[model samples]
Target: MNSRFRRRSLLNSSEDNDPMSVVSNLFDVAMVFAVALMVALVSRYNMTEMFSQEDFTMVKNPGKENMEIITKEGEKISRYTPSGNKDSSSGKGKRVGVAYELENGDIIYVPE
Candidate 1:
């Protein structure tokens, strides 16, 4: 009778240990890691406004030839790239401001 009870207990323990449980646990861990990575990246690049409902603008690689201007307004997003022209104007608008880059790479805008 003791041997029969031990055999039944072993079978019960084996049944409780499902192989699929391990896979599910691994999937949960992966999802948590992915979320953490996304949060870190967003904060690192100051991109938290991207998830907000208000309008926002972002400049990537500012002052460089490959610079990109991203603007989000009222559920619409627009991307503007420099046309490789030394003068950044459409030849129709009057100049309203001037921007100067400081030695520390900070840009200052002075309205004319």
Candidate 2:
């Protein structure tokens, strides 16, 4: 059986080892890689669009006098509630409240 199989293999090498097989496999791998890259790009765009309004900040080793509050929206950013200044005689003034206008033409007041 082994002798017959070897004889057939030697006689018909074209069926077992196609010259285009290597090229076809490489093309398949490239197509898969391109598809994966496309998927990753689309997901990244969706994630950025969905969480566009959401933002955050960090305060490292805040001083004892006061703390700062920061707000961000896209490229525009705003800071609120500045720290206390020792030179000022009145000291740090407390935050009474803040009124924000919504996109749907509504006002919301946030109190500290």
Candidate 3:
């Protein structure tokens, strides 16, 4: 038999049926899917950080006795002490406000 014909017959024979090819193909497909999922997750996380603005104009800067927390959605939550007293009153001393910049180049403080 010719070499080409012999090779073709060998490939067509049942003994040449290798199960490793199926396993290797499945492994390749799974690897591709895993890489795609990881990339998607990383992209989504990066997009969230990109969309959130961290900088905000100081509507009121907190002093040593006060605490100010700014949210990613531009909401400012402030906690401060009463005028001269050292102790804090939850109902009377705590103040909440929203910080926004006005069109006239001024920062507007809106009490919430």
Per TM-score, the best of the predicted structures is 1
TM-score of each: 0.65, 0.34, 0.34
Q: Each candidate: how many clashes?
A: 0, 0, 0
Residue 104, model 1, lDDT: 100
lDDT of 3 by residue, 1-80 (tens): 69999999878997459888889899999999999998798797553443446634232346654544333444443333
Residue pairs with backbone atoms closer than 3 Å in model 2 (clashes): none
Model 3 — which ten-residue stretch has the worst lDDT?
73-82
RMSD to the true structure for each prediction, in A, is 5.1, 10.9, 11.7
Error of 3 at 84 (Å): 32
By summed lDDT, which 10 consecutive residues of candidate 1 come out lowest?
Answer: 85-94
Cα misplacement distance, residue 39 of candidate 3 (Å): 1.9
What residue runs in model 1 are displaced by over 4 Å at the alpha carbon? 1-4, 7-17, 85-112
User: Per-residue CA lDDT of candidate 2, range 1-112, in tens?
Assistant: 9999999889898856787998888999999999999879879755333346767654433664456655566666666666466577565676699999999999999997
Better model by TM-score: candidate 1 vs candidate 2:
1
Tell how far residue 109 is off in model 1, in angstroms: 12
Residues 1-112 of candidate 1 have per-residue lDDT tens digits of 9999999898889657799988998999999999999999999988888889999888999989899999999889999997897686668688899999999999999998
Model 2 regions lying over 4 Å from their true place:
1-12, 47-112
Q: Report the candidate with higher TM-score, 1 versus 3.
A: 1
